[model samples]
Target: MTSMRALGRDRCLQLLASVPVGRVVFSMRALPAIRPVNHLVDGNTVVIRSNLGGALASTATQSGAVVVAYEADTFDLDGHTGWTVVVTGTARLILDADRQARYERLLHPWVDEPMNCVIGIDCDLVTGYELAPA
Candidate 1:
């Protein structure tokens, strides 16, 4: 087993931005739930779109904070190398018109429902790790 290397904030953000998909973690009724979501990285914020339901929509609408994690790396059983990145912060609904437009242009929800909501996570804490063959 290899030791995990601590990744800087910049590196974490970079990895998150480069990855096209991530998992959004939030608490629902004191229980933690994680769901796969499409995200758009805008500076220090991570933007994601959702329909009218689900934990993310409900959580964001209720003014709740969440932790979004994005990881990108190759994994193999033959001692391959890879990396993982995690981001934790406060999440809220995006209400700004300009910001909404920008995020809308960048992200398109896969569902057929009307995607009139945008949730953004203020990346307050970010960390990552890399695994490589010795």
Candidate 2:
């Protein structure tokens, strides 16, 4: 048997910080769109690098702040044990040149294309669960 345990905010954020990649859920053409991307946890926020021309960046810029969800997880399929985390919050483009430059240095995109924009998602609600052997 297996048991599921709920994780607290602190632990959830910690687990999120431990992972390098996650899926960001956002609105695209009035529909939910998800994209897998690399990220970094900065304080209570998750930061991702994207091209200025990308939908995510453009949406955030146009709306100032967009509600979004971020999910990341790791699982041991054989053992059925691992952790999953989801964060809901507002995503905004980091407008400060210095901060944007700092984030660019801290997070490198997976692709070779130019990623000139940095988006920060301020975590408002964090929920997580851990599955373990009973």
Candidate 3:
């Protein structure tokens, strides 16, 4: 049997930083869209690099700070042990040159494309669950 437990905010953030990739859920054309991107946890924020022409970047730039959910997880099917984290927050483009440059150095794109945009999601409420052996 397996058991599940709730993870606190700080613990959730730590788990997020341990992972390399996650899904960023945002709105496009009034519809929900999800993009898989690698990220870095900065303090209590999640940062991702994206192409300037991408839908995410476009939406973020046009809307300023947008509400979104960032989710990431890892699990072992055989063992039924792992954790899932979902973060609800506001995302905004890092437009300042210095900050953008700093993020550019800290984050690397997984795809072979130019990622000219750096967005930060300030975590407002972080909820997570961990499954483990009972």
TM-score of each: 0.85, 0.96, 0.95
Clashing pairs in 2: none
Q: For residue 48, what is the lDDT in candidate 3?
A: 94
Clashing pairs in 1: none
lDDT of 3 by residue, 75-95 (tens): 999998999999999999988
Order of the predicted models by lDDT, top scorer first:
2, 3, 1
Judge candidate 1 at residue 22 and give its lDDT.
Answer: 82
How far is each candidate from the true structure, as Cα RMSD in Å?
2.2, 1.0, 1.0
lDDT of 2: 0.94
Q: Rank by TM-score, highest first.
A: 2, 3, 1
Q: For candidate 3, what is the TM-score?
A: 0.95
- Score candidate 1 by lDDT: 0.76
Could you give candidate 1's per-residue lDDT for residues 1-134 as a string of tens digits? 66567778898788778867888877778887887778878888888887757767776677655555443443565775567777778887788899889889989987677878888888887878877655
Which structure among the candidates has the greatest lDDT?
A: 2
Give candidate 1 regions above 4 Å deviation: 64-78
